[model samples]
Target chain A: MEQWRFIDFGLVDIRDMMAMDEAILKGDGDNTFFFWTPKKSIILGFFQKAEVELDLSKCKDYTITRRISGGGIAFSDDRCRQINYGVVGTIDNDLFPLDIIESYKQVCGVLIDTLVHYGLNAAFRPINDVTVDNKKISGNAQTRWEGKLLQNGTLLLDFDIEEMLRIANIPKEKFLDKKIASIREGLTWLDRELGEQRDMEEVRNVMKKKFEERFHVRLKTGTLSSNEKELTKNFLPKYYSPEWVYR
Target chain B: MEILKTKPGIHKARGGLIRSFVFVENGILKDITISGDFFLFPEEAIFKILENLKGTPVKREELLKNIEDTYAKEKIQSPGTAPSDFTESIMKALEA
Candidate 1:
């Protein structure tokens, strides 16, 4: 059985978080499962333009940044109750598939299992979403560097729908076309589903265990390596610059 | 010389919602920027696709051919998006 390094990097800033994620992908290290939360911020998909996806005037209260992964926009903050986790590793067909869609199924299945352990009726919605009661609880995205792959997902513990809507410029017609009626109808969170706020540490424990059990690996608690730290230092400037975020 | 007009269009593709901001002058695509929640593999290829489409005639057939050529050249592996989906969004922007 392979051994994976598990690091819970709780509550980092959005830019440093992005830099660290990229550093881990590019740096040589053990296959890692990383958990973190960002200080209040809105993260955009790599391809999304800030002007199109965000109401900049209404987003004054939150930091706006773009991640290197391709997917939909997401709002993250510990206060709003969101947890983020990333799985970084080289391509291994037996462990994780090479195909993008198939890989989403493989990684998202772990999330579904974690949610199920908490007694939520969770399911994997393809491309990349984990849903409970047919409403999305998690959205995931991926990016590749050389032979390495980094897939990260946002798990909503308790969502602030109004805040999200205020910052994000989602079209009302988008909901109508999906027959979703309203944005609230299309999203759900762990607290909403369970009727109580789950302890963050407990949730993290469950995810660590689920990941270890499902993949038949031992998760040794570890921190970023020296090389990863150096790479992150080099990458930090790019992530912090307005040129990168607004471009 | 015609004034370049930036027209916006939105389309919900099988993959995800795609938005296109096309700058057209005299029925010629001067520049374009495609943005959306859709996933495109080798993600940087989107820029190349846009760069390649500059100065393309805004007609449906011509737009499709240019985009298709770029898709093929990039060896794009977008799961739910195809060249035609982008072309449709771009065409919508042109018409708008």
Candidate 2:
């Protein structure tokens, strides 16, 4: 049986995290965990073409990067976002895709428990999204490699909807006064919903506790190994290059 | 000619983002237009790349390779902008 681990990093780059995942896939380290990113960033899906999904002119003024997993594009920043990543070994191949979906359920259960603890109505939505009162609060994506599964998700602690709308180039008709109001009606924030602002550390602690309780495993704190550092150095440039980032 | 216009699912930013229109004629890629708010260095360079890519087949791997090679020659680092970005955007449009 493999042991689970928990790591909390304050602010890190999406590129570094991608590199670490690549190293883990290559069998360079044990299963690990960490979360850190600046206030504003957009991570594109692995197979996504960057030009079509992002306003590159707008992104030039912000931090944007490509991720290793496949999914839709997502925006995250300091005030409204926290990243939680988990890597586990000892996966059962016989389960295949079911294991992948079940993993989401297990992790989302922790989030639901934490939200319930905080007195918020939260539940797991199918195919990888967590919602509160039928509005999305978090979106998750996953990638598997060599008997290991790396699942990570973004929790919306606080987000700037206007900024999100601005950076992503939302359709302008939606910007009309009443239309914008209608759009806002469909979105919710944790700070607003909970009636209090929650800091990153507080959220991290709660999620860590809930994850341990739900998975029935102990989590240890650890850092990326030397091999991981080497892998990242080589991998970062490739990931950052147009070859991988665009195509 | 079969022309299809669609949003590239890969790039997630909202406004003035690039949209791809793929033109296939006789089962071959006749042309593709990647238009939006992205900036390309030496703006005309994008048109030049597209002009050259006009007659290529609509296959995914070939399109990716040609786009990659063309951008490498231009010394353009990020393709998420104009021409190169347009190429990637078109590929994603085709996939979707």
Candidate 3:
């Protein structure tokens, strides 16, 4: 069987996490499956305007930045135990299909499998969301650079709805078709779904296993290569700059 | 005849919600800013569409055709949002 590198980058600053994603996509590295938790922050979709998506007055303490992928806004915090995972590899491989929607389905399928293993009825909602009973538990997005594809996602172990509402300016139009009246009514987390918090390491293990099974590859624990580290270092300033974040 | 005004419009298409802020002056599109949670391949295509709409007459059919033309030229692939969705939001902004 083929082997893919797997790295668990425990906890990283949100900006550094964004930088690393771009670095891995741009650098020549082995196909990688990485896990990490980001420090408190609100990550904007590539196309989103921060001023329109965020209530800046309430986000003074958060690290705000825009990711390379196009999706909705995402809020992550290590304290809340939000877990993140990414799969990065060259487009030449069959692991990720060339069609955007098809690839999203394939990547999000892994999350659905992992959730099913936990006895939850998780389903892949088109575009890029994993939902349990129609409530979103995870959101994912992807970006392609040259020949490489980087798809990253967040799995909410627990969500602070009040905190999220305070910082995010989720427009009411987004919920027009859905029965969702508020963010709380439209979201579910592992902790709330299971009635308890699952061990973080245990959850990561399941993710690693599901990814391997779905893609038919072995995940070998590994770390970032020298090239990836250097690229990440070079890319840090862009994430830290207000020009990119507010753009 | 510089009567500049900006208005916000929001619409939920089959694929996702598209929100737009349209700036108009003297019944002509001055500029437009489109942002949303929807996924658009070659994310920069939105800007191209905005540029194409500038100076367009503030009419539903014209706005719709310009947006459609940009999508065709750019080969825009927004899974959940269609050109009509964008036109709807932009038209809504103008009407507002």
Q: Which ranges of candidate 2 are over 4 A from the true structure? A: A78-81, A93-97, A170-183, B1-21, B27-96
Q: Residue A16 of model 3: what lDDT?
A: 91
lDDT of 3 by residue, A102-210 (tens): 8888888888999999999999888788999999999998888787788999999988888888888777878757777776788999999999989988998898889
- Residue range B13-92, candidate 1, lDDT tens digits: 76778888877789888878877898888898989899999999988899889989998999888888888889888877
What lDDT tens digits, residue by residue, belong to model 1 across residues A1-247?
6788988888788889989999999898878999988888988899888877887888777777888888888787437578799999777876777888888888888888899998889998877889998888999998887877899998889888887887788876456655787988999888888899989888888888888887789999899999999999999998788887777
Per-residue lDDT tens digits for candidate 2, residues B1-96, read 222234332332222245566766775778666544333333345556666677778766667667767777875423224333455556666676
Per-candidate interface DockQ score: 0.56, 0.06, 0.56
lDDT over C-alpha atoms for residue A223 of model 2: 72
lDDT string for model 2 (A1-247, tens) is 3465556656666666667667665656665555655445677765445665566777775556676665556677556465555554446543223355566677677778878878988988655668788676776766665566666677777778776666664544322422344445656768878888888678878877887776666678877778877887888886567776765
Candidate 3, superposed: residue stretches over 4 Å from native? A92-94, B1-6
Q: For model 1, which pairs clash?
A: none
Give the TM-score, chain B only, in order for the candidates. Answer: 0.90, 0.64, 0.87
Winner by TM-score: 1
Minimum summed lDDT over a 10-residue window in model 1 chain B is located at: B1-10
